[model samples]
Target: MDLVTFQNTILPIKDKLFRFALRIVGNPMEAEDVVQEVFIKMWNNRYNMAEIKNHEAWCMSVTRNLSIDKVRSKFRRETGIPEGTDWRDEGLSPHKSAELTDAVSRVRQLMETLPESQRRVMELRDIEEMSYQEIADLLELTMEQVKVYLHRARKTIRQQLIQSESYGLQ
Candidate 1:
């Protein structure tokens, strides 16, 4: 593809790529770097891109691999909610907003406690809203395996939420 074609076809997926990278790397700045690297890789391989089907999934796989590589290079990483985000809900009362934030935080914490596969599967399936086949393709898992992981992840989170609710949302 030429420059304009590349920009039109490729540039739109940048945000999704960034979000996937951020999900893995857990740092916005690092995610940005990963995205830049992905773009560079895509540009370099632009001629070959047409041979591959499903560019979005291809991009997501690349992002996932690069982010995992980045994490491996670093010593340790603990993250959630990509710090410094302010996603305000204009309709919510302040108290309701606080509750929503806390609930989200709690769910994130619960996700952190899950195994890596389970957490990643949950994020891809629920958060990103990818189809099972797409997830299986990207994660290189069987469809049944993807379903099992997602089901377990949701079951665990649901149970945790129920437990927390019983305890009155401390």
Candidate 2:
């Protein structure tokens, strides 16, 4: 595809891809590298892109694969720990901001505890707002599997959040 077409089609989804990569790789710098690599791959193979339907799904699939590959290559035995959360918000009181930050951090911790598949499914469905069919196509899982993982992930996070609230996890 031409630069204009590429810009119109591919550029819009870069943030989504970067977020997915960050969720998997857990480092902002590494995530940026992953997105750049994805862009390079896409640009290099632009001629063949037309043969693939659903560019977003295809890009997501590539981003997931690449992120996983990066994690595995760099840390075979280490699980990724998410970093670089922006804990700033305007207009909130300090107490409120700290409370919100703590809650978000707790949820991020809960997400980290999930099984990789469940976490990925949750991020794709909830964070990226992808459809079940699209997630299935990208992850090469059945629709049922994606739904089950997402359900389990959400349930686990919700239950954990409730339990933490009960215990006062601040």
Candidate 3:
């Protein structure tokens, strides 16, 4: 593809790619770096762009791999879990809303405890709203495999949420 066409086509997808990377890496700055790297790689391989059947999928796959690599590298360098700023203190809420929000927060925390593969599947399927085939293609897994992993992840999350609600974690 020509530079103009490539720019137009790929530029529109940058935000989606960034969002996917952000969720995978759980860091906005790292996600931005991943997106930039993806576009740079794409630009470098512009001559072979036509050979790629699905450029968007290709870009996403690259971004996902790079984000996973970054996560692994960061984990190795860090001794404990990474800390991020919480924004929940900004809002005022009724008792019911507060309780529900707290439950949701707890669920998110529990989600963080899941395995990376399961968490990625859950994030792509649930949070990013990606289709099964899309997720499978992106993650290089079979559709059946994606479904199985996603089912297991959801089941684990549901069980944790139920336990937390019933026991009321202090």
lDDT of 2 by residue, 1-170 (tens): 99999999899999889888877776777888999999999999999998988788778888888999999987875654445554224335888777776668677778889998999899888878889998898889999999999999999998998898889885
Best by TM-score: 1
Models ranked on lDDT: 2, 1, 3
* Deviation from native of the Cα of residue 170 in model 3, angstroms: 11
TM-score of each: 0.83, 0.82, 0.76
**Residue 46, model 2: Cα distance from true site in angstroms:** 1.5
lDDT of 3 at 165: 69
Tens digit per residue, CA lDDT, model 3, 1-170: 78799789998999889888877777677788999999999999999888998889899899989998989998988853357654333333667555666657777788889888888888888877889999998888999989988999999988887787688772
Worst 10 residues of 2 by lDDT: 82-91
As a TM-score, model 1 comes out at 0.83
Candidate 2 wrongly placed segments (more than 4 Å): 76-100
Q: Assess each prediction's global lDDT (C-alpha) against the native.
A: 0.84, 0.84, 0.83
Instruction: For residues 35-58, write the lDDT of model 1, one tens digit per residue.
Output: 999989988998998898878887
RMSD of each: 4.8, 4.5, 4.8
